[model samples]
Target: MPVYKDKNGTWYVMTRCDDWQGQRKQKCKRGFKTKREAQDWECRFLLQQGGDLDMLFKDFYKLYEQDMKARLKQNTWEHKACVIKSKILPYFGEKSMKDIQARDVLTWQNELLRHRDKHGKPYSETYLKNLHNQLSCIFNHAVRYYDLSTNPTAKAGSIGVKNAKEMNFWTKDEYMQFSEVMMDKPISFYAFEMLYWCGIRLGELLALTTADFDFKNRKLRINKSYQRLKGQDVITEPKTKKSNRTIEMPDFLCEEMQEYFSMLYDQKPDERIFPISKSYLHHEMDRGVKATGLKRIRIHDLRHSHVSLLIELSFSAVAIADRVGHESIEITYRYAHLFPSKQAEMANRLGELKKGGGF
Candidate 1:
């Protein structure tokens, strides 16, 4: 470790580490305001070079972020990076990975629990859980690759939950009332129509182009998704492997979409049919909800609304899951309550079988 004061009175550090070829190389960092700061940086640098758990938490997180950024979708990775930077970095940035204890994690969690937003509401359980998971993942990476005894987060226990308890959706009749008013705006109307009738995710809906629609076959293809990131509109592959699917569009919906396309002026086959920003859709939703006086639900709830409709029409879980591009188990589990109980029907069928002596 070599700590030196530069000409301008700022401190700097020169450290030595082995490169990939196993040759010793000198690394230099500047701009430390104090001698202690330079010494701390050198210590962390040496520990990191030693490939052990003694590196600073913030330093290890940088490596973890580099690994994840390459692995995740741009939109998904941005959200994860934002959460980790905003919430987890503040408390642990200067702390050492080797010194963090279970009690320290508990204290951080308690502070999070006591925090309130501008709305005076504490963070939602799902949000809290995600934050904790992000923190735990940092330590888990260290345990797997770096020499670490145990994850303090495992001993601290996680806060919040994996999923929210409340689920919301509109009945078919309610959607009818809403769509009735929505017809005044063709774009809004057609968008909601597709969401409710086709059961596609919003991103999938936005990424649609003229080529995706096969009017002759009455089919709509979903192979990509849209995301608005950092003031730029980005198109990426769909959320999951199952998300790339083809759906049979109802004739009425096909007609409505054709009419909507006619409203556009020379839009290219590759151009998005719905070119508006997501905020525009949210604003339209606000107007519709206010005018219809219907209970408010998120745009995503339109997906749930579709699932609920499928259940009511007596579609099996597998059929509904295939249509919605979700795993059958997720459909059966998330909407389990909405699925009708068949205990009585099973008993009656069994009784009929007994009478027929068809064992």
Candidate 2:
């Protein structure tokens, strides 16, 4: 009833529906080459209009993307979109949303676990977890919106591959040694110094501008972050609400920043403090690591090192979380083991108290 032939012999599907406000409206799609295609399109369109479960995953994904565009940040949307297009769609694109069962999802998860990239290495657990999360999100969205009766991901337990590799971080002595080698490269030295001492994320560090700093008050504001997604540089809000915070810089670091500012010709308020790309930063870090003959770690380890140092100095978890713009103290607790053990000192004090007969 909804299919018709166009003037150029192509077929079209048109459906009339009542809008949310009760007004009648027509939804039409053209350029179908066959009557069957037109009828299929009409069927799906009508089902979608009636909020029935009749669309394929690929079709539902289009609607999901439109819903997400208004709710998610640019970087998050882009990441999810990339995952869906590259990983999820290839396997489940044509499958009906209602027909994708737990077993099917489990099979896909196993395939992902066994999948090897060009490097012949299986995807990291964190990456696998992210991919699983994206899949779960799509299914959950479908269930919540009544497009599907159940979420297959709910029963597809633990799709993420748990790798036991320990996270890498540097101690104070190692960082000091690395800094000694970085001294010759002024930009790298300053950048690493801020990263280590401030404990800001790489994106937050890259987003820094002259106006964000207050040398007189020894404070720095973190309100935004910079990221490269889909080969484009994007500036967006900080990762979380708590990430938008003010940090009081140490006196020595404040002085170093002042000296660094003096050498820069462009001192405009909006001028970027560190106008370097991620690749350049990695290059300098690699050179410094090799020259210092220290344990190689990612640039992000500098943030971990900063937290370790603060914990060593007896800073509370809340204090460290505030300084580093962590969403919660529980995140800081992840580095609890890195804190220097005070057990020996506590035992020594107890011995002294016993010797003095003070209980």
Candidate 3:
């Protein structure tokens, strides 16, 4: 039994109890003027208390952590935890699981829209899309187990449906200009070369140990990557099954890598091929680009340039996909420009196959 106040003054109400476990003894402070209002309010409040949204979220995460440990690979859990901490937790960590609304998610998305990276570039549409995707997964799990109102992220919708237009790749002369500027910084310069020629990721490149290179076979093994998990750097397995493939190094680059290896301070087979921090490598890359007067060229674009060159050299899509560790041909299709120009050139030769009429 509880006393409550209203415009007419105070009135008494008593909650019905069945058992100790089912009974809700909490009192409402505000007085409901009508008997129906009071009954509805009590019922809703009791339902909410029974739900215990805070406890539900905490318990859900505990189950998720356990399932992740048992079902997911170490690298997968590490990656999810990293993103959850760095990109997600700081925003929605304390939010009530059931009360979090669509607007709350939209506000967070808007904030991420204006967010910038360490390099001062605004968050890419691609990056935001990925963040939203991860958030959606988390919400989906919550909804499945915790009885949330709904997944707030599901209502946020996509930022955009279309991807940005393709970027301009470098010409042969442009690549030469880039190389000339980077001559003084051999490690950064050659690291770029390796990524371009080998078509492996920067993470994969850094994770390479000396023993992974097969000089006699002219092959480079790529099985691991340096990933940032929970703000700490760690060597982890690649993202997909295809990422474990070995690639043949170009003759010239192979020779250069051999020379680079010989110049290493530690000649141990287990030592990292490039023994520099990511920052130092990126700094050198930026410096070289600046010195070359090509500020628009990104390190990633070097990979694009390499794929473009391979297309010009007439490699098939399957071959290109294999080299680049693309899980599907759909991904390879995004880089299709490499082959089209060559195809057009080859098509021009079709005119030569026709016989010419005599005058």
Candidate 4:
């Protein structure tokens, strides 16, 4: 490596490389402000010849984003970029990829663990795990493609857990109480009905249009999901292939929606059934919960409440999974853990089976 300075007070670096025809070539890059900048450029130039691992983490992350951004949905990529820019980059942006060790990763994890927000709140365990996974993923990419020794995160181990908290949901009676409170507003009532009865995601529910409902057959077709991203409303494919499904509507719900539709003046079939923002739905929930004095739950908990209702009705995992568009029956079975009160009921049924000489 050779760095030189001229009377003009600028620094430059030169390097030798082999040309295509087996000829020696001298490449010079100039106009860096400081000798450190010149040496840094020279170091990167030599390391480009050595391996990709010596590049700064930020530079490698750009490569990572280039390779990955096109493969993900816009909203998904936005979330990853936000996390990387906000949480991961500040600690390791300028560090060389190959120089980050398990201890360095551990140090970063401790700092994140102790981090507090403006409201004096720490990141959720799941969020901590998400950040760690993002950092670990970068290293994993290097190991798989750049011939790095190992993923330091694999050695450091992962923080947080997959299911950080138990499911929060309402029973049929509890939901009925809340639903009664929402009945004063027809839109709120019908929206909660769909969420509790169909077990669809908020995006899927918001994406529903008048044309999607077949009142004659009491069925609802779900194909697209709605997202409010970057200050625009976006309609994208459902969360999974299985999420593109048809749900059978309850007779009462079908009747209720029919009445609700009748109230709309000159609404088109293509228009959203509920042209309301998520904030509106949330506010309605707060109002309903406050009016009914019921246990407070998130809008998503309505979906869980639906699944639990199915479990209580003795529905099979496969049936529940199909109804909810779960990717696998195993996912539906995860809700089984939420219903521990069923243990005594199971024992009682087994006792009856023993008395009847049945296994």
Candidate 5:
């Protein structure tokens, strides 16, 4: 009854609906090519207005976005929104929530795994997992709030496979070799030194200001991180509660930072220590790699290198976790392989006890 034909030969649906406060409002949707399509839309719209379980995924996503805006950080909300827009919405936007099935989700996930980026590289396992999680979050929200029958994503299983390539990191000697190249670029030298010694994330490093450094106490406080989203730079709180920590700097590094700060005359406390963009940092690292003739590794690998060094120094996992801002020692267990020597030493001590006939 709400379907009508427009003068431009398009079909439309017009209806009156009650808003949240029970106030009457007019709702109209146009541009359907056929009367049947317009009628179908009107039926769905009426059902939705009547508080029934009939709503398009695209429409549901709008509600989801509003819910997430208050519950999630801006950067996290932006990431989930991007995944919905670029991946989830393209496939499910027009489908009703009740119409989506586990099979459809599984098929879509497989397609995502098979797809390649513009550079012809497949999406990383971590990235695929993030996408899967975002999809799951949306469906879970729908099931809980909108009374949807089930979450298809719940039955879709894991979307990303574990990465096959071995994790790459540098040894102290290799890092020293790289440092030789960094010496010529003072800023880069300081940056890499901090990254290696402090084991801070690149975002945390970039967000640093003079106020964060306590040269007198040889300590650095990490409370914020820098992120680039939608072509704008954003400063946000640390990723986790444990990420907000203070790290002690070695005496030599403290002396170096003192000299570096002196070079920046008339600098404000709030101004970023490293004001350059991430792309510029990458360029400098690439140049350093070429100059040093070292095997290439990402900027993030500097943190791994620091962890390996700490493991080699016989530091406890708990101590390392606290120093590196890991939420727990379980997170630090990923570097267990680097401490194989400790395991072997324990085995040797057990053998000695066995020989001595002690329990």
Candidate 6:
């Protein structure tokens, strides 16, 4: 038997029953605003308790978080989780997994465009788009395995971002100035030198171990990268298949690496080549650049400088791509303009051909 009351304090319905053993069950629950809502809840509860809806909101969210963390790399998970904590949870934390819809996602996307962070910087189109992408990925897993009715973000499209002009790499003189600034810091100097000569990523550079090098053979192996994981830094395998490669070291760098190896001979096999934290290295580099009045340059720009120098030396695009571990030669072409002086050199070569008077 059951009893229900409306919002206005009026009774809606009452039911009673007696057991076969003549036992009376006195269950008097009230407070639903309407008879229909109470009836609907009654039916839903019965079905839900009988396992008709096995996937609860908390269960789906738990699975979503687990799958996202497992599939995404540690840095990626941390970044994406920042977005979810700051943006997604406030809106949808209490939302039912089954009731989420495309409109809800669309509204969230629109709101994100208008929202700004505590720092007052508006969200970039790329950031918004990536957040949507991560959300879609989460929902996709839920839809595929958790029995979600539909993916709320299925219709979401990329936020249209205009292409910006390519950036300029450091000129030879700029590199010299940067070099002069870093001369006193051996690790910083050698790290920058390796970037300009070896085209290794910053993370890969930090992940280097003495054993990963063969100074006598003048070769450097890149197999792992230092990535931030769970708020701590850890060494992990390269981010992509193409990210693992061996590079030939210049004679000067080979000499330096040999010295570095000799100095580290007493250290453990797993010790970091540059035992300094990334933040400390960045801080030192910034101080050096400021003291020398050098042009502003990002750490990544050192790798860009390496690729540019190779291009200026007329290294084939395929070779550069292989050296830099780019999956495609097209990506290598992005650095072609770094050797723009070749335009004039090619023009001169064309003039020489014209002197022969041939097409």
Residue-by-residue lDDT tens digits, candidate 1, 223-288: 999999999999999999999999999899899899999999999999999987778888988999
Regions of model 1 farther than 4 Å from truth:
16-26, 349-359
Best by lDDT: 1
Worst 10 residues of 3 by lDDT: 10-19
- Where is model 6 more than 4 Å wrong at Cα? 1-59, 117-120, 147-150, 160-168, 231-233, 329-359
Residue 111 CA error for candidate 1 (Å)? Answer: 2.2
In model 4, which runs have C-alpha deviations exceeding 4 angstroms? 1-51, 118-120, 339-359
Poorest 10 consecutive residues by lDDT, candidate 5: 158-167
CA lDDT of each candidate?
0.91, 0.84, 0.70, 0.87, 0.85, 0.71
lDDT for each residue of candidate 4 in 1-359, tens digit (9 for 90 to 100): 77999779999888897665878899999899999999988877666544478888887888789778998888788889999999899989989998889998899999988989999998888889899988998889889877989998998888876656567999999999999988888888889899998899999999999999999999999999999999999988998889889999999989988998998888898888898889999999999889989988999999989988887887777888888888555555577575446678998999999999986
RMSD of each: 2.3, 3.4, 9.6, 4.9, 3.3, 9.3
Clashing pairs in 3: none
Q: What lDDT, from 0 to 1, does candidate 5 have?
A: 0.85
- Candidate 2 vs candidate 3: the lDDT winner is 2
Tens digit of lDDT per residue, candidate 3, span 1-359?
A: 44355567644355643334775454534655666666655654444445446543434455557645767766677667777778877877666567678898899888888877789988766667777877887778767765666888888786632345355567667777877777777787778778767767878888888889888899888888876555676787886788889899878988988878777785777667776666776787677667777756656666777777887787777887788777548446676544556567666666555444322
lDDT of 1 at 164: 75
1-359, model 5: which lDDT tens digit per residue? 65889999999888898888989999889999999999987887676665455788877787777677888777888877888899889998988878999998999898988998789999888788878888889889888888888899888787774443456888989998888888887788888889988899999999999999998898999999998988888999998888999999999989988878887868899989888778888898899889888888888888888988898898888888899899545545577677655578889999999999998
On a 0 to 100 scale, what is the lDDT of residue 10 in model 4? Answer: 98
**Per-residue lDDT for 19-42 in model 2, tens only?**
889999988889999999999888
Better of 2 and 6 by TM-score: 2
